[model samples]
Target: MERPSLKSWAEAAPRLVAVAAGRDTADLVIRQGIWVNVQSRELLPGHDIAIAEGRIAYVGPDASHCIGDKTKVIEAEGRYMLPGLCDGHMHVESGMLTPAEFARAVIPHGTTSMFTDPHEIANVLGLEGVRLMHDEALLQPVNIFTQMPSCAPSAPGLETTGFEITPEDVSQAMQWPGIIGLGEMMNFPGVIGADPKMLAEIAATQNAGKTVGGHYASPDLGPAFHAYAAGGPADDHEGTQEADAIARVRQGMRAMLRLGSAWYDVESQITAVTEKGLDPRNFIICTDDCHSGTLVNEGHMNRAYRHAVACGCDPLVALQMMTINTAAHFGLERELGSIAPGRRADIILSSDFHALSVETVIARGQVVAENGTITVDCPHLDWPDHARSTVHLGKTLGAADFEIPAPAGANGVRVRVIGVVENQAPTRALSADLPVVEGLIEAEGAVCQIALVERHRATGAVTNAFVEGFGYEGRMAMASTVAHDSHHMIVVGTSRADMALAANRLGEVGGGVVFFADGVEQALVELPIAGLMSDDKAETVAAKAEALGAAMEAAGCKLNNAYMQHSLLALVVIPELRISDKGLVDVTKFETTELVEKVLQ
Candidate 1:
């Protein structure tokens, strides 16, 4: 379908006004509400909104002049009318649901707009996968804009992905209808060094007059960061400290502080605005990656707003962070982010600013949601059979595949371990001594064996390494196909047999998460779509995710958001230690490390 031309929309203005003036009839009219003017930061009471042709035609004291006899009237009953929330940065696949289901889950929370990067899917299916996500997003009741994925392997040579995205691909995608901009440029090193491919992608986005997303995962805000900024990324979401937030804004990049399902970055970074008095407009709130459980139970962008407010930001400032600030940064200020003329008529009715309970939601002049229920349809795409049958294990194996063999005549060995920090993205690299049982190294106390099983192809390769901070006590295992970037299978366990059982179960189910203990499966969440998302309803997925969480705790694994840590094991871009299909990656030096120790012959 072709988009309506701007000139054509402007030509219809007289008809819209005629409908609003009662000469013709409006489709919907909302009456008697307090308008929360974001531009002026004032709550003006006793206003009515008249909608025609999916746009706000009139908003004033008395819409009785605008309301025709046939118009459907909705009494707002003195609730606060605010523009619907917008997420500045996110990954749609992280919700473990398709775009349609993700829209259904967040619409009740008043999130009407989202800026998404389907990089995870792009890594698996390439440009075609991105187009599939974009087409489905355009079919939703709310707005879900796509950013062409910039980094596919994320870090070149560190890991191998199922597909590769080139500069030509980036150029072609810039012309896509829903392509908002380039996805997060995660390869900061590439940008700083002026790699031709990275510069070409940025040039394409700039030539199209769109935004460029950023991901500088390093803590060094020195010359390297300056070089990255010079390379032309307009916004960044990897800031975890007040200095990080302040630096990004000073460099003319919007500082996006995120509060995802696992990442608790807002509390530490919001102080840049609240305490240090930095310009709040330069900072935005986002949930970069949220699970379906967090969206359905806790909230979506609403949760991010409440978190910012709880962190001492003004309530109005928090709301702006999730709305206008985001829209302006993404170059969509004229189309969204405010309850103003010519903007898409997406508004939310709430009772309180602090609590923020959405009573009603309007998208494109239509009643999309009311009283925590979606009223409109969000269309879903029929996924191809190839996408569903992605999980591949060469052959089902026993516990022997998970065993890590030690060096000759070794009784004890010192091993480098990846330390999982609770509720944070970066993990610490620590070394520990463990007892060697026979020829195999065993996890004695706080450490456990983590394996990255190749699931993209039927390679049947498993890379084993040691990790700490999960605090697993019993002989249990947790396996997941939600591994980031590469989207392989990650299994963490104290017992090899249980790990094997968990991995084989995921292979049998096609894709999902599973927990096993003492030769029995405890919980499983089947995500058959691309092995990254489930076709089930949000509530059903959340319930199963919650059960999986409970099972993780019951098996003696004690870490906040351990499931997130489990998913990120294959993400080689992040610092410290990670495992890929090739070998164990020591990210601190960006080199591959062998599982065995080097010794004199």
Candidate 2:
């Protein structure tokens, strides 16, 4: 089931030429439509598109010459015919579903192309995991390009992942069928410091003439930012502010504005194009980390595109950012992002540009979706039992495993707490004074206990710390194996008993997310595949995720998409504060720091 390659196109050139000239019939024809020409940034009315062999043969004012008795004709009826939307950057694992299920969820929303980074799998199973994901991606009906994971531990000396990706791995992955380039280089500090290993990974991707992704999470626009830009990353999607976006594009990197399940970064960064009037060509739209609920209930790339338009960007400008700009950024301008000749026939028919109501989707010269319903099957891989049984906790844990000892003879201790910011990724490093009971420190009012349990090695090692901003009360704990960058277990709770129970439950169910209150199971979403994704349908996973959110609310924790924040508590690459298997990391300093700053007098 391999699609047409360059050689196939050369072999079929004469047939396509005959079809365009009306000597032979086209396989499909779209007539009476307003064709959106993304290359020229204009819309041409009453255009006819002739398709043959899954590629566009002709696009003009009429296709009567190419029509035959057996040809399929789609009457666009004056609707706008746009190129299928493209997601410039995303991760399939973040949706809590496999690549097949993720494709099934987004096909109805008009996303025909996805540039995905499977670094989460790299952290778990290394190169083999990446290959599995890549093989599955190539089987889908629409396009799903894989990027070789560039950083596994994310930040060296600060965290420990189950597996690490080396420079040789990048070189080998470049030869993969679906590999687009190296994934996001999350180790910005390593690149700025001229780490030889990091540079070698970048060089491998560059040598293959592929794009290098970026992840500069810090807000500083100082010398480090310039050094990272010089290190060879071509685009970045981690900008959370107007300045961050401007800095990236100014440094010759494409600025990716994302609107994910929890990260509301588009409104702040879209100002670079909408208000400040920066070149829109250097900007693109993406959903960095969207869960199944958001993909099912809301939209995919369509959501980000509409958000940009609502933020005052021109409708055509927003569309270009999501379509042509994205394709051009990946060096795929000729293969996608337009309805002209010599491009893949991936088109969407919509009645309105403002609302972006996708009415019909044609991917690779075939009708794949119509009126918000999928018409084609998204193929799935037969994942082995070992892939589904990755959660390994050597021994069951008790309440004592989560306890933190206080300084001797101290009544209270001031501890550095990771503060969760609503609708953002970076956490604020704050300090809180908590009371000491007996010889252990106890969580006071708003502060709660957070622990990083090492589930990969099954050694039962736990690193404990404190955190705020979820506003959890009562005896409740939330545990997840979907911790970012490193797929370890992160448990945050007010009670140590509940924490241990929730963590042990994930190990029992293979791996997934669980919420516990008063030692009672409130909700669970089992992601048995590599402890990161589910094999179920997207709608089924979305429903379970919704229930998980409700359970978090019922436990007195109220933050927007709080589960997203919960998963990133252990991400040591992001700025400010984070926890890892090694210890608490001060990400800005790129080193581990003490949990307690000072002791009480």
Candidate 3:
């Protein structure tokens, strides 16, 4: 389908002008609403909005003159009329559902706009994957804008992806319709060092006059951080501390504090606004990654808004952060973010600003959702069979594939382990002394074995390592093909046999997550779409995901949302230690490191 040109506003101008001038009737008129003006930061009562051609024609004290016999009228009954919420940064794939299903899940939560990064699919299917996500996004009932994926492998040399994205790919995607800007540049080191490829991508987005999303995972607020900020990323969502949030905004970049399902960074960072007295315009709220379960049970941007309010942020300030503040960051303030002339008629009705009960949701002058239920269709693209059949594990594996050999004649060995930090992306590079049984290292205590199975090239390569946390004690294993950047299969377990079973189960089902315990399959969630997302409804996927979480708990793993931590075990860009297809990676040094180091007495 051909995209609507920028002259759409011009085309709708006659109808809008007619309605505003009281010469013609509006398609819809919402009367007597308490306007929560995010742009002006004011609460004005007795406001009536006139809508025509799916755009706001006029918003003022009264629209009684614009009402006609055919005009559909909605009495707000003294409800707060708010602009539809906008997500400044997120990954649609992380929802474990297609863009259509993700929109279905969040529309009722009053989210009408999203700026999504499709780098997860890019790692598996390259530019073609990104285009698929983009096309589907445009078909949604709400405004779902795509950002050209800036990183496929995410970190060059540190990891390998099934497909590599080139600088030309970035340039070409910038021209694609509905592409807001370049996606988050996860390769911060590459940007700081002025790598040609990274700079070329950044230049392409800038040349197109678009925003550049950022992801600086490091906690360092030093020279490297400043250099990355200078490398042309307009906004960042990886800030986990108040200082991190303050520094980004101070440097003229939007500090996006995320509150995803597993990532709880908003509480720590929102203090920058409440206590530090920084200008709230440069701050944004987002969910970097939310699973299907979170979207179904809690909320989307609404959840983030509520969390911010609970953290002592003023309700109006938090709403602005999610609405106009986000829209302005993407250079879309006039086109969206408010109920004003020429803006898309995307608005929400809430009974209380503090409670945030989204009673009614309006998108493009039509009621799309009301009272936690979607009213409009979220169209889907025809995802071909080839896209579903993405799992390619060169050959079948056995228990031998997930084994770690100890040094010769060593009774006990000290091994580098990836320590899982609860509710955070970065892991700790920890060392543990473990028992060696017949030259084979065994994780008998708090440490467990982790392996990265190469599914991209089907090389039958399995990089074995150890991981702390999760507190697994029984004979069980969990496997998933949702490993970040590379999209490889990650298997973590106490028993090698169960680990092999879990990995092979995913390979058999094309790609998804599998949990096994005591020689029996405990639970499974099938994600046939690039092993990252499911075509199934978000609710269905969430149910299965809840079961998988239960299975993890049954295996003695005691971590909140442990599946999220399991899926990111192979993310080599963030922090201390990660497993890759090649070997164990020490992310701090960005080098492959040995598994075991000799400890002398």
Q: List candidate 3 stretches off by more than 4 Å.
A: 2-7, 599-601
Query: What's the true lDDT of residue 402 in model 3?
Result: 86
Q: List clash counts for every candidate, in order.
A: 0, 0, 1
Residue 473 C-alpha lDDT in model 3: 77
Model 2: per-residue Cα lDDT over 1-601, one tens digit each: 3433322467667878999988999999999999888888888899999999888999999999999998999999999999999998999999999999999999999999999999998898889889889988888889899999999989877787889999999999999878888899999999999999999999999999999999998898999899999999999999999999999999999999888999999899988888899999999999999999999999998888888888888888888998899889889998888888878889999999789899999999989999999998888888878888777788999999999999888889999999999999999999999988998999989999999999888888999999999999899999999999898999999999999999999999989999999999999999998999998999999999999999999888889999999999988888899999989999889889999898996
Backbone clash pairs for candidate 1 read: none
**Candidate 3 displacement at residue 318 in angstroms:** 0.4
Report how far residue 83 has shifted in candidate 2, in Å. Answer: 0.5
lDDT of 1 by residue, 500-543 (tens): 99999999988899998887898999988778888688999999
RMSD of each candidate?
2.1, 1.3, 1.3
Task: At residue 362, give the lDDT of candidate 1.
Answer: 90
- What's the CA error at residue 159 for candidate 3, in Å? 1.3
Worst 10 residues of 1 by lDDT: 1-10
